[model samples]
Target: MNKKSLSQQIYEARWCYLFVLPCSILTGMFVLYPIGMSWYFSLLDWSGFTKDAKFIGLQNYAEAINDPFFWNAFSRSFIFMFGTVPVKIILGFVIAVFLNNQVLKLSPFFRTIIFMPVVTAIAIIGIVMTFIFSPFNGPANKFLMATNLTSGPIDFLGNPDTVLPTVMGVYVWKWLGITMMYWLAALQTVPQDVYDAAKIDGAQGYRLWIHIILPIVLPFAIVIILVEAVSALNVFPLIETMTAGGPFFSSEVMEVYIFRTAFVTDAGTMPRLGYACAAGVFWGVAVLFITALQGFWMRRTRRI
Candidate 1:
């Protein structure tokens, strides 16, 4: 290419990079920077309490595999992911469908009310949920008592049997709006002619959902499912705010456990920074794998 043409191209490229420089720098400092440091730290044995860091290779990973607490937390992540994603997707779709009906009035008001929690403080919701789950003097138990549904108080958050479910419920409440909004956007894009054709073909209700609406919204549904899967696997704030994975670690997800390992422990002037780094690395890799699989499935579905 001529020098003038090449110079013009270089100038354009330089300006493009300059425009994106701020975003790239922020991402590097906040995201890529930590990831790089974590990878380095994962190869060392550092009691986060001091500067006495010793390089220990893959020992932390070895210990992580054998650590019962680590495995328990890891397993809990999957269970919570499985419980939350399907419920969120299905309920969000149903709610979107219900609200989409022409007969529904004041739809914007209802949508705003539903989405309020999405903007609420995580700590506030956690505290409110904790109160609601309180066995004594909680509003929920008061309702149950007044209705005679149960004479006894239900310690929803305290009981190991119910902690996971309680957290799951909190997750649904927090995320349902976002998912519903997504579904609503997708539904609005559905061609009206398709529904008209379906009606003429004697397709209605469940048949229409199964044969028409679903097929058209399949791409939207796939995106939500994959997004939910990855997010649920990394669930933290609600758990952090509500249970703190407490009541005997019954509700502990991988995230809270990792943070606890990093900052909450002291082994006679020793901290476990390296182990925490390893755990962080493990979680990141797990998320990446799940995302890759999701992309593959989405591609296959679109092809079909």
Candidate 2:
């Protein structure tokens, strides 16, 4: 049979194209349009409020490069990603292993309990966590004091030294359930027969896990870690609600930095929309590079 012409193929799949039209339109409007606009705005000198925007070429980007606060925010984002991703992966895998045990009772209930936070609104969790970790009369400090863990209340969200780590901890706790679910799914891919055969051969417990189960689930673990690493960079809402990048901008990630530059202007200074867009474009490229790296690694792992 002859291959169909492009026009003929289009005619045959007209209904499929029709079905995809709405999503394509929405994506163009929301995703593509904004991306294009961001790049265009990055080359301009616009305050976002004024109708007139002067084209300044790459000055905004150059300014961003020299800006110390921009570098600080960028470093903080990576720190958060590095801090949370490993803890989430290891802890999530451990919890998933425990829950995946066939002899364990009420595993489903425990899974639901753990996963509840994943579905909870970040804003709500942030608010509740802020209150819980409040420096004065907060439940956490109260407990610590009660147990004599510390003689004085610790400002978990207030101190610059502690804020980022405290935020990282909350982020891991909030998203741990999803990572656990990923591990649980990976665990399910191991056949019962494989486990039984391993048992028959006297391979059990840590030996069975390290030798057999780990090899089987290694790919999934890698993918999960990469995905979570990307996710760990996006904690704007939680940080905003809990600390608002407070105590002298200690917790300002890229997202918060962009928002502050684009919208939050101090007295006598206009909102630097163009500069913010430049920063955003830079950060977006970095994230895109990371995502591409993830794809490359995943492909290599699949080949192996």
Candidate 3:
């Protein structure tokens, strides 16, 4: 016989609010606070740790627009995306097909072996890769020398011409298992009757995959592309530990660039927290833009 006010309704649901309050508070503290602080910092000239955050208005953004190195790093992020994403998607899909094969016994064991690298530490992977690609006595070099491919070690990761591609190869190798799992999960969702019908229609092997399976898994492929695209832009630790963005910054990506600008400047130079925050903000906006484009394209494709 009575209507409750919004406050009264909330009061009645206090326990539900209490249940979600911790998560909300944590999100505000970690996510929202950092974003707000970063945006504020982007407008100031401060060393990240110091209290002297002098407001500089939009000077940081202005500097970023003219900064050649920043633009180079931005371009390199896209290069890294292009170098890794397609290869990983194609190779992962192929591996998923092999693993999903009905005749393949011990598929689980192979899958476990392949996926081990996904759980491995990037630092460890980089270190191991460094040793493996070492010119002196690395296994790869040894194999090459033994096979008479060259007179000596090729310096795969040490050469500027090769380092980015080498890093891409290692990145693809480490993450392929996870991508394979995504594809495999998508593949498993396809109906058995669909395969039966395809087989009855004389579609076999590659034809069945191309005609039927691919259409079914296109959505999963889009998800994988979006995920890997964002991730590939943020590549740092692998490039850090493996190459240190060196061979003269040939492998420097957005994250590595942000870190170097923020904290790892020349010996006498103070950290440019504001400038780095601007760079970070720019990267965040760029990623959001790219992801938005991906979402739009996916929606458009579905409409078609």
Write the residue-wise lDDT of candidate 3 on 1-304 in tens digits: 6999999999999999999999999999999999888888999989988887899999999999899889988998899999899998899988998899878899999999999999999889999999999988999999989999889679898788999899999999998898999999999999999999999999997899889988998887788888888888867888889988888888888889999999898888899999999999999989999999999998887776
Better of 2 and 3 by lDDT: 2
Q: lDDT value for candidate 3?
A: 0.90
Give candidate 3 regions above 4 Å deviation: 1-5
- In candidate 2, stretches whose alpha carbon ends up further than 4 angstroms from where it belongs are none
Residues 9-50, candidate 1: write the lDDT tens digits: 888799788989999999999999999999999988987768
- Candidate 2 clashes between residue pairs 3 or more apart in a chain or in different chains: none
Which candidate comes out best when scored by TM-score?
Answer: 2
Best first by lDDT, ranked:
2, 3, 1
How many steric overlaps are in each model, in order?
Answer: 0, 0, 0
lDDT values, one for every candidate: 0.88, 0.94, 0.90
Question: In candidate 1, which residue pairs get closer than 3 Å at backbone N, Cα or C atoms, i.e. clash?
Answer: none
- For each candidate, what TM-score against the reference? 0.94, 0.98, 0.94
Per-residue lDDT, model 2, residue 270, is 93
lDDT of 2 by residue, 1-304 (tens): 9999999999999999999999999999999999999999999999999899999999999999999999999999999998899899999999999999878889999999999999999999999999999998999999999999999999999899999999998998899999999999999999999999999999977999899999999999889988898899888999989998888999999999999999987899999999999999999999999889988999999889
Query: lDDT: which candidate is best?
Result: 2
